[model samples]
Target: MNSLELGAIGNCSIAALIDGAGTLVWGCFPRMDGDAVFSALLNDARTAHDPRAHDPREGTFSLELVDQLHSDQSYLANSAILRTTLYDHHGGVVEITDFAPRFALYERIYRPPMIVRRIRPVKGRPRLTVRVRPRFDNGGIRPEITRGSNHIRYVSPAQTLRLTTNAPISYLIEERPFLLDRPVDLLLGSDESLQAGIETTARDLFERTWDHWRSWVRSLSIPFEWQDAVIRAAITLKVCNFEETGAIVAALTTSVPEAPETERNWDYRFCWLRDAYFVIHALNRLGVTRTMEDYLRFINDIVEEATEGELRPVYGIARDTAIEEVVVPHLSGYRGFGPVRVGNQAYLQVQNDVYGSVVLASTHAFFDQRLGYPGGNTLFEQLERLGNRAVALFDKPDAGPWELRTIASVHTFSAVMCWAACDRLSKIANRLGMADRASYWRREADRIHTIICEQAWNPDVGSFVSTFGGRDMDATLLLLHEVDFLSADDPRFAATVDCVARTLKVGDYLYRYVAEDDFGKPKTAFVICVFWYIDALAALGRRQEARELFETVLRQRNALGLLSEDIDPRSGELWGNFPQTYSMVGLINCAVRLSRHWEEAF
Candidate 1:
C-alpha cells in the first residue's frame, strides 16, 4: 500500500499491514523498543532474506485486501480490545480481533510478551493463507529460525520469537502459500523456552499481555463524544511507549517521508522532550498514574545523566543521549523517498525552548498535585534549576521550536516559553512556601512577558510576529492563552487570532509559520497548528466557532482517523510525518477542552 493508504488503515484494520511483509509491523514484543520482527517497510530486500516472503507482482500469491473499510477502531468499550474486519472480494469476510485481556488473578506488574491475532472466518472458507516471517534488531540482525511440528522458533542473542500455528502450513523460502482448514491461532512471543514449551507458555503469555492492556484501559475516564478515539490514540501512544523506560516514541515506523520521493524522511522511533508535557497531561487526564510516574522518573533519570547539565532535544527509547543521523544507502528508501535517515540529527540542534518545555511539563505535574505535594516540592526544585538555566540563556539565538534551517533572531515562541518557565516556577515555589525564590522568579517572568509583549507584537499588523522585529504571523502564538500569558478574550488575542486566520489559514488548514517572503519552499499548513487554533477559539468562548473549526479539521483525518503532521490543502492529502504525536495530542486536548466548555455552557 502507498503511505497515504497505509496511514488511512491505521485504526481500521482486522490485520493491520504493519510492515511491507504483511505481518504485524508496529508492535512491541517484550517492550516498545524491542527488536521489530517485521520491518520489510524499512528494507524491501530484507524480505528476500527471510524464509517467508511474498511478491504481489507474482500471480501465485492472490491476496484480497480492502481499503477505507467502514469501521470503528476502538478499545473494547472500556477495555483495550482492538477489533478490525476483513471483507473478502468474493463476499467472504472475517473479523480479526486482538486484545491484551485483563489478568484474572493477581495483576502482574510486568506484562509477558505476546499479541493475540484471532481470525474468525465468518463467511466461506475463502482459501485461508498463512505465512510467518520474523526479523530481529530493526532488520539489522538475522535470527536462526527452527521449525517444530506446529511451532516455529526464531532465536537471536538477546531475544526469541516463537510462532505457533494451529493449522498445518508449509514453509517456503520464496513466494508460496499454504491452505488451512478450521480456525488458526498464531502466538508470537519472547522467552528462552518458547520453542521447548511452546503450547502452555505461549497461551499464558498472550493472556497476560491482553490482561495488562485491558486493566490499563479500564482506568480511563472518557466522555462519550471522544471515548473511543481517545482510548485508541492513547493505546497506540502507549504501545509506542517503551515499557523498559517511560519514554514515548513519536511513531512506530521510521523513514515514512513527509512528502513521497522527497528527502524529508526522518526516524521517529526516538523520544522527544517536546512531547513530554502532552504525554503526561493526556495520561493524567485518563487517570493512568503509573505511566505518568514512570515517565517522570525517566525524565529525572535523563536529567541526572546529562553531563552537560542540559537536556538533548531527543533521546533513544533506551535513554541513549547520542543520536547521529545516518542515511542507509544499502536499503532502498521507502516508496523511493531517497536518503532514509535512521537517527535524528535534530537532537544535536540547540533548541532553546526545550528547557522551558521540560520545566513547564514538570511544573504542570506539580501544580496538579499529580506528584504528591511533598514529593512535588522536590520535583519543583529540579524544575526551578532548569528554569534558572532558561532565564540565563533566554536571549541567546538557538534553534527555535520549528528547528528551522536558518538561524533567526529571538523567536517569539521561545521567548513566550521562557516566560512560561519563570511564571510556572514562581507559582510553584510560592504555592510550596518558597517565598524567598518566588519574588525573583516572578520579577524575571514579568520582565520576560513585558519584553515579549513589547517586542514580539507587531503594531502595524496588530498581531504577534514570529520573531522580534518581524511582521510575519506565527501559529505558535495561539498557545498564549494555553500558557495564561494572555487572556483569551483580550483584544490583542482576538487580533492575533484574526491575523492567523487571514494570513496563515490556507483554505481550511493552518500553516506553522509564514515565510519571511524570501524562503523558498511553499509549506503546507501544519495539522497540529490548526487544531491549536480551535483550542484558542474554545478558550476564548467561541464555542460554536471552535466546534465548527474542529469538525472541519477532523475531516482532514484520513479514512481511519489518523493525522499526519501537515496536509496538502488543495488536494486534501496528508503531508509531513505519519501518525504524529503532536497532532494526536492536539486532537485530544481540543476535544477535552471543547467538551468541558460545552458542559459548562449546558
Candidate 2:
C-alpha cells in the first residue's frame, strides 16, 4: 500500500516525494504550489483487498525491476540525495540515486526546479522497465508526448517536462523491459538542451550537490546526541524553504489525509506565519540564521504590502495574497480518501497569533551580530503595526492556532501570543534606546498579561484552560513556559503542563485537544504537540521522563527519520502532510534540549 514512508528530496525551488521503490509518486513542477505534474501519491490507493485498486490515470515515473523482491532506501550520509536498491529474485540488483541539483555556480547560488535520477546495475543482469508518465491539473490532463533521439518532452499547455536521458528513448517511451548492463542518467527538468553529455553532466552536478549539503551540515552546531536525526531534520527544514522567495512551505505533499476514512486533509504548500516562526526558532537554536534572515525578508515584504497594517496567516512564495483554497475532484486522495485540496482556507481566517509569530521570528535579527542584515528602527516601526493589531484583536475571538472553521472563541494561546508581540517589541525598543517606546510596549504587554492571568486560569480545574474562562485543556498551554510568559518555577506553569498531560495523553502521544471542532474530535496526535510536552517536561525538571518521551517520539519517525504533521496514536503510523516542517522543527528542538553537552560526553 502507498504510505508516507517515502523519502523527500528538493532544491528549495521544487520538491518531490519518492516511494521506497524509487518512484516519483508526488511532486509539483515549475514551483512548489504549481500544478501537480506527478500526482500518483494522491491517486494511487493500492490496497491488500485489491492491489490494482489504484487509479489508472498515470501520474508517476517508476524504475521497476522485472522480478523485484524488496527495496531499501536511505539518504546518503548527510546529503539530500536518496539511494534506493532493489533486489530481484535471481540475485539481480539495481541502485537508483535521486536528487534535485542545488549548489553554487556562476558566483551565485544555483538551484533549479529539476530532478536528477541515475539508474545502474549493481549485481547480475537486471531487467528493468522505466515508466515516465506525468499528468497535469491534478491528474485532469495528460500532456502530449514528443520524443527525440536523445530527449523526450511531456508538454501540457501549462507546463512542459523534458526528460533528458541516456537510456534508449524507444524503450523508455514504450513501456518495455530492457537490460540495464550499464549506468544511465536521467535529468527531468525544463524543456532545454543539455550543454554537455547527459551522463557527465549529471555526475558533476551530483558531486557538487553532495558537497554543498555536506558542507552545510558541517557548519551546523549540533548537540552530541542524536546527531544523525538532527541533521536529517535540519536538512528537511532546509528543503522546505523556497529559497527563490524566502518562503518556507509547510510540507512537500499536500492533502494526505490526517486520518483514515476522513476528509481532514488540507494543503500545506503556502507559507504560514505561525508555522514559519516555529521553524525559525528551532533553526536559531542550532545557529542556522540564514533561513531566518531570508524568511524575515519574505515577511518584511508581506508587512510592506499589508494595507493599513492588516495581515493574513499565509501568503504565496511570491507574496501573492489572494490564495484561495480549491478542491480538485479529479484525483483520488491518499489511501482513497478524497477531497484533495489546494490553497489553504486558513489564509482567509483570522489567526491572531501571527502578529507575535512575526515579532518573535524577527527578534533575532535585532540582536544577533551573525546576521548579514540586522534589524533597526525601521523594522521595529513595521512590527509595531502588527503589535497594534495584536492589541486590538487579542481579547476578541477568531480562529485560534488550530484554525477552527466555525464558532470563534477567545483562545488563550492567541491572547498570550499577542502579549508576546508587545513584550518582544518592548525589548526591541529598549535595545534601540527608545525608552519611551519601550515603556509604551511594556505597558501594553503588562495589560494583556494581567488579563490572561486573571481570565485564562480556572480555579475549579486547578489549571489554565485553552480559552478564557473555559474549562477544557489544550496542548498549547504547555508553551506558556517556553514562551517565557510564565516561569518554569511558577506553580501555575507546572499545573498547566500537568493538566494537559492528564487530559490529552493517549498511549505515548499527546492530542491537541479533546473537544469537537468543525471536523469533529481530532483523531490523530499533532506530532509537534508531543514535542512541546517533552520540552515542558524538561523545563519542569522532569529530566528522566523528558528523555524517555523524546526517545519514544523519535521511534515514531518514518524510516528516513522524517515526520508528518500527525500520527495515529493507536498504530503509530504517520498521517497528514509529508515532511511537515512543524514536526521536523519539533524534533530539532527536543533533541537539542535533551542531548548531553559534548564536554560532558567526553
Candidate 3:
C-alpha cells in the first residue's frame, strides 16, 4: 500500500514523493504542474473491469531490497536530500540517497528535470531488484521502452525520459536480484550522456547540492525556537515554486481529496492568489524576499493579461488563464476511490478577495528595499485600480474564500480582505507622499469597516458571523486580529474568537466551518485554519495554550516532517494534497509569532 506519510525530494522545478519504505510513489515530470510519471499512489482500479488487464505495478518505481525486514527514512539536515536505509533480517543493509540535483553550476543554477538515485551497500551483502515504470498523460498510458548499451529510453507522446544507470540493464529489465558489489548511480533525465564517470559525477553533484541547500538555509532569519520545523517548512515551500516564471503552486499533486469519499478533490497545482499571498507574507517574515519578488512578477503578469472586467482567484503556473475542469476515468483516485480530476473550475468564479490578494502581494514591492522593482507613485496608481475594484465588490455577492459552488453570500471574510486592501493602499499612498489619495483610500476603508461591524455581527449569537446577517461561525474570524481589522483587545473581537473556538474547534483541530456546502459538511480540519486558531490564542494572551496547540499540530506532520491540506480530526491522519503551501505558510507564521525573542533566549 502507498503511504500518505511520504518523503519528498525536489529541485525547484520537479518533485517526487517516496513512500515510508522508500519507493517512488508520486511525481510529475517537466514541472510541478505536469503529468504524474509515477502514478501508483492512485492504483489502477481498471483491473477489476478486465481479468486480463496489465499488472498495476507499472505505475510505480520501487527498489526492492532482498529479504528486507525493516526500513527507515529521513532528510539530510537543512536540505532537500532524502536518505532511506533498508535492513535485511540476515544482517545485510543498503542505503538509498535520493535528490534532484540543484546547485550553482557555472554562472546559473543547474536544476535539471531529473531525479537521481544512488544505491550503496552499508553492511553484509545486500541484494536488490529495481523496478522502473513510468506512466504518461495522467496514468492513462504507459510509455514505450527501448534499451541501449548503458541506458533505457521511455518514449511518450508528450516527452521522452532516459534512464542512464550503471546497474546491469538485463537484471533491471528481467527484475532479477543481483549481489552487492559497488555503488551504482541512476540518472533519470532527458536523453543525454552524463559528462563524467557515473559514480564520480553523482558524488560531486550530491556534495555541491548539499552545500548549496545548507547555505541557503543558513541565510534565513528564523526564530530561535522550533528551528527544525521552521527550516523544513521553509524548504518545502521553496521547492513548490516553479522558478522559471516565479509561479508557486498550492501543492504539487492533483485529486488528493480533502476527505474520504467526499469527491471534494480538486487540482491544486495551479496558483491561488489568496494562498500565494499568504505564502509570500510568511516567507517575508523570514527575510526570504526572493520568492516574494518572483511571485510579485508572476502576479503582475497575470494582472497585465487579465480581461477588462474582474480578476480570477487562481491561475495556471504557466499563466494559462482558462483552465477547464476534466475527470480522468481510467485511473482510480488516491487510495482507490474514483474520479481522478485535472484542472480547476474555480478559475471561472469571481472571488472578490482576489483583488485584495493582488494588492496585498504588490504592496510588499513598495516597502522592501531588496526588490529590483520597488513600488512608487507609478506602481501606487496602478494598484489603485485594484483598490477601486475592491471597493466596488466589497458588498457584492460572489464566491467567497471557501469557494462554495452552490450559493453566494456577502462573506464577512471577503469583505474584510477588501477592507484590508484599501487600508494598506492608504498607507502606501501616504508613504509615497500622496496625501489626497491616501485620505481617499483611508475613507473607503473606514466605510467598509464600519458597515462590516454593523452587519456581520450577530447580536443573538454574540459573535461576528461568516456572512452578513448569518449565524455560521467560520475559522477565518480568527484572522480578524492578524489583518488589523480589529485590535486584539477589542471586546467584539474577543467575543468572536471565543465563539469560533467553541463552534469550530473539534478537539485540538479546527474546521473551516460547521455548515454544509454543496457537497455536505466537511469531515476534516483544514490545516491552515487550525494555525489561525493558534495565532488567535496567542493574540488573546493564552500563550501557554497557544504553545501547546502549536506543538500538537507540529506532531501531525508526516514521516518526512511535511504537512498536507487537511487532517482527520478523529484519527489524526493527514488528508488532501501533499506538502500544501498553505499548511507550510501556517507553520512559519505561527513559529515566528510564538517563538521567544533571541535576546530572551540568550
Candidate 4:
C-alpha cells in the first residue's frame, strides 16, 4: 500500500489497497470517492512493527506474523481476492485472504462497501497480532471505540465503522500476539449486526466473490497472447468503475506524485470524460459492451442535463459537476509528499476536448444492436448541442487534452477529436436515415478537417505540432491516424509520428510533452502516451518494433501486472495514481492491436 508493490481488492462499488504482506491499508468508505477510512497508504508515519508507538499508528488494519521470516502474495486465480502466505522463523506458516464482497444477491449485484479478511494457519502454529486502527477526515479525527461481544464500533463525527471478528476481542484491543489454533474471520463494514456468524458470512462471500470475478474473466474475448496481462488490466479497469452510477474514475488513489518532491500531485478520484471514453472504448474492444452500456446511462444523463450544452472536463462519481479541490491538511502524501488533495478542480476548467469525448462515447448507442436501448432522435438532437460546442471550440483555445492549468492553446488533438465527433455524428445520422443531418455533419467534419490540416502542420516542426502554429511536439500527435484525421499511408501522418517519437521518447517510455506547464517541465513518461506511440507504430506497419517496445513496457508493471499513471524512465519505477485507468486502457488496447490474430496463432 505504501508503494507500487500493492494488490487491490474491490467490489466495483469501492476498492482497498493491500501490501504484499496482506495488510489492508487504503480504502474509502461507503463509496469510491468517500472518506478514506484507512489512510495509511498516504500517512506512512509509523510501520506495523511498532504498534506500541505513542500515536499508535492511525491508518492500518494489519495482521502481523510474529517473528516473520518471509512472505509471498498473489491474487487467487483471476479474481480480485488476494492471498498472502507469511512464514515465521519458528517454522510456522499462515495465509491471509483478503477481498471485498461482490456477487449476485437478491437478484442484483450485492456490493456492500465492506472488506473481508480470513486468516488461517497453513503449516505450524503461527503467532499473529491484529491491528485495526481507523482514522477519519484524512486522519483529522481519531475515533472513539466501543466493544461488543463479537463486534467493535469505531465512532467519529463524520462516520462510524464496525468490525465483527471471531478472534479474541481482548487480543485485538490490546494488540497482543496469539497462537493461531483456528481460523479467524474479520468483516469490516457498517455498524450493523451480522445476520449470520462471522465465519459463515466470510466463507460464503469469499466463494461467491471468487466465482463472480473468475466467471466474469471467463466471459471476456481476450487476445491469444499476453492473456494474463490483459486479464489483469481488464479487471483493474473494471474495479475503477463505480458501478452504482456507472462512472469510471481516472485512478483509485490520488496525490501519488508524478515524481518525488516535484509537487505534481493532483486528485484523480473523479472521472474525466476523455479518460472514461478511452476506457470504455478499450473495454468495448474486448467484447465488454455492458460496461459501455452502463456508462452510457451515466453519460446520457449528463447530456440531457447539460446546461447550454456545456460540459466540464471531469465529474464526481455521483454525477457531481462542482468537485472543488481542497487540500487535506492532516495527512502527508505517499512517501511523505505533502498536499494530499481530494476532489478535482479540473471540473471547473474549460477543456474543449470533452465535447468530442461525449459525442464519441455516445455515438455507439445508435450503432450497437446488443444494447437494449437504441439512441433516438432526442439523444441525437441532444448530441447536436455538443457538436455545436465542438464546431465553436475546435479551433478555439482551451486547456487541451493534457489539462495544462496555466496555459491555453488550440491543441491539434482536441481539434481532431472534434473532427471525429462530427464524423461519427454524421455516421450515426446516416444510420438513423436523417439524410439532412448527415450531410450537415459531414460538411462540418470536412470543414474542421481541412482547417486542422492547414493550421496544425508547422513547416518548422516538419509535422503536426501540439498547438496550432506552435513548434513543440506532443505525444498525442502520434494519434492522427488513430482518429482518422489522417490515413496510415499519409506521409504527413508518418512524419508526425516520427517527430513525436524523436522529441518525446525517453528510453522505451514516452512523455506526454516536454514543455513547461503549471508545474515545471515533466520529469516522467505518461504511461498511456507510450501505448499511443505503440499503436502508431503498429498503424505505420512497424509491428515488429511495436511488439518489442510493448514487451518492454509490460516489464514495467508491478509484480501484480498493474501500472500507474507515470513511470521514471531511468529507474523504471511507477509513480502517480495507483491502478490508473488510462494505463489499464492502454494495456487492453495495445494487446488487442498487437496480438497475433486468433486464426494465425492457431
Best by lDDT: 2
Which of the two candidates, 1 or 2, achieves a greater lDDT against the reference?
2
- Candidate 4 lDDT, tens digit per residue, 289-404? 88899999999999889998999889999899889888887776786765689877788887888888999899889988878888999999999999999999999898888888
TM-score of 4: 0.98
Please give the CA lDDT of all the candidate structures. 0.64, 0.91, 0.88, 0.90
What is candidate 1's lDDT per residue for 92-155, written digit by digit as tens?
5555555432343564344446555565566654444454555565555567877777666778
Candidate 3 backbone collisions, by pair: none
Worst 10 residues of 1 by lDDT: 7-16
Ranking by TM-score: 2, 4, 3, 1
Q: Per-prediction RMSD in angstroms?
A: 4.9, 1.5, 1.6, 2.1
Off by over 4 Å in 3: 44-56
Q: What overall lDDT, based on C-alpha atoms, would model 3 receive against the true structure?
A: 0.88
**Cα lDDT over the full model 2:** 0.91
- The predicted structure with the larger lDDT, 2 or 3, is 2
> Comparing 1 and 3 by TM-score, which wins?
3
Instruction: Please provide, for model 2 over 309-418, each residue's C-alpha lDDT reduced to its tens digit, 9 standing for 90 to 100.
Output: 78898888887788888898776778778678988888889888989999998899899999999999899999999999999999999789988888688999999999
Model 2 clash pairs? none
Cα deviation of 486, candidate 1, in Å? 1.3
Cα deviation of 96, candidate 2, in Å = 0.5
The reply for model 2, stretches above 4 Å from the true place, is 45-57
